[model samples]
Every structure is written in structure tokens, then in C-alpha cells.
Target: MAYQTFRQEYLQVPPVTRAYTTACVLTTAAVQLELITPFQLYFNPELIFKHFQVWRLITNYLFFGPVGFNFLFNMIFLYRYCRMLEEGSFRGRTADFVFMFLFGGLLMTLFGLFVNLVFLGQAFTIMLVYVWSRRNPYVRMNFFGLLIFQAPFLPWVLMGFSLLLGNSIIVDLLGIAVGHIYFFLEDVFPNQPGGGKLLRTPSVLKAIFDTPEDDPNYNLLPEERPGGFAWGEGVSWNC
Candidate 1:
């Protein structure tokens, strides 16, 4: 009965977010078990191009180091915000959420090349938080039960906390930058007088991932309005 209950809860997670969190956990587990070395997964341009270790490009974004404080912290934020965005803002729009992942990853990878950084998982998490915060601007949020702020300032708050941890602010800044770019293109610019949607999801992906609106079982909930940006209405997430 206990196992069945656990299975039921596990099955309740949305698909994209579930797969992502599972990958992060399994990747870290592989490291903790000594099945793989962190060195092998980190981004190295020479190894990627010359040695043809193409897997590093994607692996680098998967592992957040062995199980510890940083790993646990990042995983929690990643899973929470990613799931929220997927089930809330990106609900029924699976293709667009996947596109956001691809877009953020590509931008982070390109920046990683120049910044000499490895393991962009945290930055990716920051990007997700940023995008979600922007879309739900009127929402209120509490940080660590101390600082209270609106949704948009969440990214900067994380960055400030990172600074206090003696960690480099580069990663957080990169994430905020990338997230702003996505928000600008997808939400902001598209609404401008002359602008149009720049980040169009391909029809192939839409056909495969998107849920059909005409389906009889599709229950359009009020919380899922405007891609789940029902700000100042839903319960706030304390980050």
C-alpha cells in the first residue's frame, strides 16, 4: 500500500518537469556511486571538438556535483520552479515549455564557452525562476522567510544570496540575462506596437507535445488562464 501510494504521487508529476528532475537526480547519483567522474561531464571545448566527446555538451548541464548542500539546494529550486512553470504557465503548452528549455540551454552553452564555466544547471534554474516571475509579475513572494518582494526581484535575490555564499555572481548574472532575453522576446516585445512573436514553436513539436484544445476531457481551469499567470490569486511559493 505504501509503495502504491508513492507510485501514485510520482505519476502525478507533469511529464517534462518529471523527466528533467529525474535526469538531474540520476546524473548526480551516478557521480556519488563513482560510476562517472565529474571531470568527464564538465564542459571542455577541446574535448568536445577534438576528442569528439559530444556528450559533455549536454552532460555538463545535467550534473550539479555530488550530493551535498549545493546539490540539494539547486535541485529543490530547480524542481519546484520548473514544475510550477510547466504545470502553471506552460500548462497544455508542452511544446513551448520544451522550446524554452532548448532556448535557455543553447544560450547558456554558448555563454559557457566564453566564461570558462562548467555545469550550467544552477543558471538554468535561475532562468526558469526569472521567466516565471516575469509572467506572474503581480504575485508576492517570500525569500527564506526574511525578505519579501514581488515576483520579478526573485532572480536578483538569488544572485545576492549567491554572493553571500562566496560564490561567483557570473552564473546568476548569466541566467538573469538569458531569462530577460527570453521574456523580452516572448512576452514583452511581442506586445509592442510593431513587434511580433519571435520565438515561434515549430509545428512538428506542437503536433507531438501540445494537448489538443478541442479534446472533450480538457478542463480549462481558472488557474491555467493566460498560461497560468493568474497573479495575486494563487498561493505564493516561498523561495
Candidate 2:
């Protein structure tokens, strides 16, 4: 049964596949162009006591890389998870994928600051993404190409990592909070029957501590939207 869902969700062309492809290309470019330099990563080349650059907050994902086995492993994960989330099988609410990529990157940067290290910071940020994807209800992914299986504990596994690392706990938690608020605002304001002045909602402004929950992402996007199925007419993911 799970295998069937996996095949359906990940096999063929997931809705966000194109986005995933773009992510991979950018990552490769960053690495090849030497743009993924450590000196340029944190906006603090010397690693001395200095303030954040603000730009690195979002530019660092383009710098993701690891030596030897870790590099290939995470690169595969980047491809795998991004593929599912981009596929649009979840049939999510308005432009969820776009927001996930954009804001998620920012959240990662904020996490990096407390981590006091660019690598660790990005790691936690990626973990937050997977956790957010897991929290999305009634959604799952199956990987047949390399990772073939089902998982109900994506969020727990991620949180568990966060728990084990005491050095990174404080900032990591903050990143989680940031991601949660983003999800809530996206789902809530517009979800309110008949759209009003969503730009001025209390939740968007305050970002107050709430239930500590965010939208769990999945291999698919909102089915209600037009792009949910078969590449939205002439568009083809295989390309």
C-alpha cells in the first residue's frame, strides 16, 4: 500500500520537479563557480565578532556542500526532497512551493547566526524544512530511484537531531518558530472565508508564539490548483 502511494507521489513527474531541478542547477553552479566560498558564506569571512550581513541569510543554500560521502548523500537528499515538494502532489494552498523556497531560505539564515557556523546553520535550516514537510497532514512520499520506502516520522527524526545537539538548540528552535509562523499566516489569513485585508492580519504582524506547529509539506501540491496534475497543459517535467 505504501509502495503504491510512493509510486504515485514520486514516480513519473511530481508537481514541483521543475523547481527541484532549478535548485539542483543553482547548487551545482554555486559549487562550480566557486560562489560557494566559505569566506563569502557568513558575511563574516574572518569569523571574528561581527554583525550579520543580511544577504547571507538567503544566499547560503546555494553553498550547500559536504566532503566525500556526506556531499553525495545530502545532494541526493536535496534532489529527492525538493523533487517531491516541487511536484505539487500535495495540492497545497496558493504558491506554497514558492514561499517554501523563499522564506525557508531566510529562516535558514537566521538559524545559521545562532549556530555561529555557516555549515551547521544551513544543516539546521534544511532539517527545519524536512520537519515542515512532515507536519503537513495526510501527505507522504515514496522514493523508487534510490530511497524506496515510507516514513511517518520525518518531523520527529528532524526534531530529534535538533534535540541531540545542545550547542545549536537555541537558534535551531528559533528557526523552527520562524518557519511555523510563515506556515500559519499562509494557511490562515486566506483560508478565512472570503478574503479580506490579509496583508494586515495580526498573525502576520506579531508572529506571536502559538501551537508550535507548521504546515507539513509533501511530495504533492494542492490538487485544487491548476498545476497539480500533468504539468499544467503543455508544460512537461521530463524536460
Highest-scoring model, TM-score = 1
Off by over 4 Å in 1: 213-220, 223-227, 233-236
TM-score of 1: 0.93
lDDT of 1: 0.87
Q: Which segments of model 2 are wrong by more than 4 Å?
A: 1-36, 43-58, 89-96, 110-115, 120-136, 139-152, 159-175, 188-239
Q: Model 1 over residues 154-197: C-alpha lDDT tens digits?
A: 99999999999999999999899999999899988878999999
Return model 2's CA RMSD, one decimal.
Answer: 11.8
TM-score of each: 0.93, 0.49
lDDT winner: 1
Model 2 / residue 199 / CA error / Å = 6.9
Q: For candidate 2, lDDT tens digit of each residue in 1-239?
A: 99999778555654444445455457556766776665565434333335546555544554545444445545655565555545343333224454455566555555555555555333534444544353443334333343322242443444555465544455445555665665555554566778443333344322431232255553333454322343233221210
Instruction: Give model 2's clash tally.
Output: 21
